[model samples]
Target: MKHAALTGISPAVIAELKNGRARTLELTSAHNIITLTEAAPGECIFVTSVNEEDLSPGDPGIMVDLLALNIGMRRIEVANSFFYEERERMSARIKVQFRGITLTRDVEGRKWGDPTKVEIVRSACYRAG
Candidate 1:
């Protein structure tokens, strides 16, 4: 039984979207943070979001896109994303296809930054889809 999963952020680079600097970590037994200039075309990657309900109760997987991540980062203007309580149960899986290699990450505490309050909550990443 595979309880742990790996996700990829396959798509255009989100560094600009994030507004903050985002470094892609090399996929190895020991996670290493690396920089991603851009994602090549025709590459396939997956971003999986899981909730507490799915963790213990078990349920379907949540689908998310890389554009959302970039948007959220852009909206917040920071690379460090924190999810709201509602989203606390939810986790994000980013699968990015850089060059010929595919990279992924399990991001937690992701949320949208409120321009007014500055307290970022509700991620726009999953808003579109």
Candidate 2:
């Protein structure tokens, strides 16, 4: 029941998230909130624990070692439906430090079972290395 409630996120992923969260909190006092919640029930509604925000619609936010944009340090704003409410809440409720790589919702936040009705975050050729 406990595991089911949290969806398909693996234990290792959870631990990684917890560790990352702790490290982030330790390194800075920013209030930006990028969290994952279950929007669908299922065989594969895996929610990653990353914000997945990027401003450049046509390219990754990486151009140089630095890009000048505002990412949810003080707040995150998105017109993307799934994240709009979440973004708004985070913006109103927290404060943080961020400069470069603005937050723009590139995909639908919800994971409704039907693939045709939903959109996944654009992470196709991107590698995790």
Candidate 3:
């Protein structure tokens, strides 16, 4: 199967994500909520979000290159879908990254309603090494 291009992602994180070893990455900011459910090195980074009320017609949700994501304090760049007018005027995308990650405590203790407890604070994208 053809896969999406991923940049700046660490090999270890890709392995973990592909092998089902890593927890889901959930990030929240003042205006948006992002969830990375699945990912692979060359595959598309499956994602969903809330609070992004503005979407163009036939929008297929958010999809990004898994490798494009910089791991270990690296930033992820995404086009702004919430504000089309601003995006057109600026011709720029938003740069965001994760910080202060907290994984789920225990499998048994995880609630059915809320299985994962991963928490990532959203911050400005850092320079990728």
Candidate 4:
């Protein structure tokens, strides 16, 4: 992630939209410094939001949830984002892969001489039915 932030774009997610409803996961990173969360659920399947950086990738939960939701699904992978907590704002890099496709993005405010706020700068692009 940091590596990509240095060079260019960060990681990202690639897949078709199964269920547009967002599923957030707060997992402590290996260092336990970052607690990722689902960004706000933006527009539905086909449309893009005005604020592209704020769109969520639609995480539906664990395996059980996936089984239930993926009934009529073909390709679905949603983990393209999470908002950082304001208590400790920092840079972020995310990379997600699904069906052999990889997407990534980076949010580096300090590197650009700006205050790192609690926000996500990555955007998820999904193929609509």
Candidate 5:
């Protein structure tokens, strides 16, 4: 039997989660960092507290949606997203429709004047369900 596709969560974390061990998943954004702890007894996922690093002092931070990752026999789903702040804060959710190979380049801490020029590289092919 084929195993579920692994995305954001690492192999070690998955193993621990399956074995009733506690673990934390850290996710960082442009200006803030969030940590996801274990879910409740029946729940399989947890969400992190909202971070407001990108917001100015006294300004309310944009509320991000709850993220979920499902590992199943037929498909895997990872709710990943990125947030950008301009005059108005906007969020871009990264979604994949099918199981396929993906390539990513990490440019953390790279300084660039133009944010729009930056891009995320993704390539995928969908299989019939």
Candidate 6:
């Protein structure tokens, strides 16, 4: 989750955030908020502790680093229809952080399963390194 949250992001996603299509996101294992397009390359995004936090959408316990503009933090978790409200509450009631990236997750974040996870703050493409 940390790896992807820091890397694995695509230019299109970044563009979306820049265009307002995407703005907030969540992380797995915890309900925290993170902003896409506010983070930069070569940074780290931190969320509430995995065990202590709920991995829901809209959590405000998300934060990122501030590097330049090559890249920015993006949403990582998407909530299921069954657990929307629960996720949003958690997402908006916590605190998180990123290493060098600039934005933080928002209340209505997006989620992508593992494997596809990408930490744009710490990675570039989807090629196995």
- Per-candidate local distance difference test: 0.24, 0.25, 0.28, 0.23, 0.25, 0.32
* Model 2 Cα lDDT, one tens digit per residue, 48-108: 2243332122321210111111233344556665555433322212111211221222333
Ranking by lDDT: 6, 3, 5, 2, 1, 4
* Candidate 3 lDDT by residue in tens digits, 1-129: 221111223445434443333244423331221122222344433222211232222322223333433223324455566743321111112232221112111111122222121222232443232
Residue-level lDDT for 93 in candidate 4: 32
Better of 1 and 6 by lDDT: 6
**Cα RMSDs of all predictions?**
17.2, 16.3, 16.7, 16.6, 18.3, 14.8
lDDT of 5 by residue, 4-117 (tens): 111233345434443432343343332221112211123222111212222112221111122342221223344446654334232222212222222222222223221111
Candidate 1 local lDDT, 1-129, one digit each (tens) = 111222232233333323333233223211111111222223222222332112222222322122211111112233436643322122222343211211222232123221100111232443221
Which of 4 and 6 is ahead in lDDT?
6
Give me the displacement of residue 46 in model 3, in angstroms: 2.3
- Of models 3 and 6, which has the larger lDDT? 6
Better of 2 and 6 by TM-score: 6
- Worst lDDT window (10 residues) for model 3? 100-109
Q: Compute the lDDT of residue 3 as modeled in candidate 4.
A: 16
lDDT of 6 at 48: 32
Show model 4 residue runs off by greater than 4 Å: 1-26, 30-38, 43-106, 110-126
| Regions more than 4 Å wrong, model 2 | 1-40, 52-106, 109-129
Measured by TM-score, how close is model 6 to the native structure?
Answer: 0.21
- Report how far residue 96 has shifted in candidate 5, in Å: 13
TM, every model: 0.17, 0.18, 0.20, 0.19, 0.20, 0.21
Candidate 6 per-residue lDDT over residues 39-123, each given as its tens digit: 4444544433222223333322223432333222335456686764322222322122232222223222344322212222333
Please give the lDDT score at residue 51 for candidate 6: 25
